[model samples]
Target: MRNKLVEFKHVSFRYGDDQPWVLKDCSFCIYENEWVAIIGHNGSGKSTIAKLMNGLLFPQEGEIYINGQLVNDTSIWNIRKDVGMVFQNPDNQFVGTTVQDDVAFGMENRGFAREDMLKRIEQCLHAVGMEAYRLTEPHRLSGGQKQRVAIASVLAISPKILILDEATSMLDPKGRQEILSTVADVQQQHALSLITITHDLNEVTQSERVIVMNEGEVWNEATPRDIFKEKTALRKIGLDVPFVALLTDELREQHIQIDNEPLN
Candidate 1:
């Protein structure tokens, strides 16, 4: 059985008393080793949930737990140790001049022994297929290559849960594919729990489960196969289903049977 790595119970958040709630009564759980995708249009509160989970923001109501410990100012530091986040802009996340230094940045902050940092840097860079680029400067690498380095930096810490907050949004189709493939390999090799916050339906198709956020709430939760089945309902909320899903829905409507699940 998978263990619950993260949980939100009736969570609510707002910037201030006068502000409208950004997250309203949101609840969900991400289990260890599960790859879950959180998707919605802009201002859907998906990103807020990501910040909340890491204690970057605290809920005004309800509770969030990471690794069974409640998320609060006091516990946040420790919780973050178990949850690593990579954001959309690869350039923004890079702090090291060279790939090796960037990958070692996180471990260095955590006060890992110099020897340990070197070992982890090597391992993580190899894991992300950037071992050859260890001496390459961040600016010299492509967007996809930089993102892989960012991912490698996060992995150096060995966090149990990895959150990719629109990490692939800025990349081209090929770059996006490369990062997704890297993430899949990292997750499988390390048994890491993955949460991808995205607007892309293609990303959703790769997840074990999907969390649909709409208007500051969790509109629905189901596997990609089942989520795509509700094409009309999804479209109503200003979200587009994948092309394969749309075609499958059309075929099914025409009284044709799809033996295999669409876009699985």
Candidate 2:
């Protein structure tokens, strides 16, 4: 059996006492080395779940576990060591003047040795195809390059779980594709669990599982192929299936069978 890397049990939360519940009775599991996407339209509580995972925002009514340890005030700091997050706005995430410095910032805080940080930085930058731009200033890079540097910074920390909270939302189509492909390659080289929160159904195609959130609750949880087949169900929750799903159906109608998986 696979080990559970992150688990949410009856989790609920709100920003203020008068605010509406952002997540109510939501529970799910993301397994080790699994790439899971948490998708929903805006205000559907998807991004809220991301903040809760790293203890940036604690649940008001339920328990969150990371590697079996309960998430609380005392455990939050330690939990962060194993959970790294990359937010949507790369501009807000950058601190260092140059690309290499930005990637090394996290390691420096964690007290990684200069020699070791240097080696890891090179490997991570290369992993994200950013090695050639290491000496360039972060502000000068394009949107996709900025996100790649952000990812490399997270990779330096070597967290067990990585959360990309709408990390591609601000990018253009090409930039978005670049970030997604980079993530897929990086994920293949590591054993970490990935939780990507986004509204884009296309982003979830590469995920092992999909957790559909609606109205502050878990609407559904299933493999991408299974979830894609349930077109009506997804539409009811305000999500539209991607073009691939439509193509799949067309091929099916013509009696064509894809011997492999529904998506790559």
Candidate 3:
């Protein structure tokens, strides 16, 4: 069994004292080095969950534990050290003028020596396959390249857990695919735990677990195969089935004899 890295214990949060709970008694455990996708519609609390994990937002009720340490102010810094985040907009995330400088920004914040900074900068850029453009200005890179730079920046911190909050939603199909491929490569090589908050089921097909939320509550949680089987349940939550899954279901309705399950 995998080690438990993070746990949400009856966690509840709201924007303010007057606001309704954005996350209602949410409880789950994310295992070490697991790639889990949190799926939901807009306002379904997926992004909120990401923020809570990284200490960007504190729970109004209940508790959050990172590596078995409670996420109070005393432990927030250490919790954040282990959990790095990549936001949706690539342009919004860039802090340095050049690609290499961008990747080095996080290391500088963490107080690494200049020599070690340079090494990690190069290593991270190469890991994301953007080493060739080390000196290039951020504006000159494509959308995919900019997102890769963002990923490299996060990876430079040597974080144990990485969260991508709609990181590929703003990109074109090809660009999205490029970023996704880079994420897979990084996870495979580094054993990084990953939490991907996305509406795109296509990107999450191979995720170890799928969590579906609706109206700010965890509506369903299951493996991909089981979740994909609940066509009516998925439709009720205003979520469309994967294209391939829908097609496979159509074939079944027409008496096709294909043995494979939808989008398996």
Candidate 4:
């Protein structure tokens, strides 16, 4: 059996002591090197779940494990080193004035030597296809470019798992495509476990596993093909089929012979 990289055991969380649970008994396991997508509507606890995975938040009633080690204050710093996160807004995440500086910030914070930091920064920028922008100001870069820089910053540390919380939501269609291509490149080459939280069905269609959350629980867990086939069930929970899936459904209705394989 494959080793589990992240685990949540009856995990639940709320923002305040008196508030109701935002996530309730949210238990799931992500394996080493797997690509997983968490889908849900606004206020459905998807963000909360992502925070828990990387130790940004701890469970109120249960436990979370990273690389088989239980996450607590004692182990959170180490766990954070192994798990990297990229939040939605590109502007908010950019701290370095230049692209190179931004990519090296995390390594610098971790006390890497100057020589090693530069080397890793170069390699990471190249990996994300942003080597040319090394000396450019981050403000001059496009949305997609900034996202790649954010990714490069995380990659410089060689994380075992990456969490993207709608990292592409603010980009244009072309920009989103560019960032996703970068994401594919990293996942393919590094075999890094990825957890992407997005409203876009297009993003989840490529995942090895699909998880749909509703009202703070795991409402559905299945392959993309299986989940898309149950359109009514998804619609009931305020989710829509992927545009490609809907188009395929329409064509199949008219007797078109299209392969119904899950899209990537």
TM-score per candidate, in order?
0.94, 0.96, 0.93, 0.94
Better of 2 and 3 by lDDT: 2
Query: Candidate 2, residue 41: CA error in Å?
Result: 1.0
What lDDT tens digits, residue by residue, belong to model 1 across residues 1-264?
889999999999998999999999999999999999999989999889989989989999999999999999799889999999999988899899899999988898899999998888889999999999999899999888888999999999999999999999989888888898899899999999999999777788878999999999999999998998888898899888888777876887899988876454
lDDT of 3 by residue, 138-236 (tens): 989988888889999999999889899999998998888788778878987889888888987777776778889888888888877678788788888
**Candidate 2 TM-score, C-alpha based:** 0.96
- CA RMSD per model (angstroms): 2.0, 1.4, 2.3, 1.8
TM-score of 4: 0.94
Candidate 4 stretches greater than 4 Å from native: 250-264
Lowest lDDT sum, 10 consecutive residues, model 1, at 255-264
| Predicted structure 1: lDDT | 0.91
Encode model 2's per-residue lDDT on 111-221: one tens digit a residue. 999999999999999999999998999999998899999999999999989899999999998898889878888887988788889998988988889999999999889
Clashing pairs in 3: none
Q: Which pairs of residues clash in candidate 2, taking residues 3 or more apart in a chain or in different chains?
A: none
Worst 10 residues of 3 by lDDT: 255-264
lDDT of 3 at 149: 91
Name the lDDT value of residue 134 in candidate 4: 97
User: How far off is residue 74 in model 3, in Å?
Assistant: 1.2
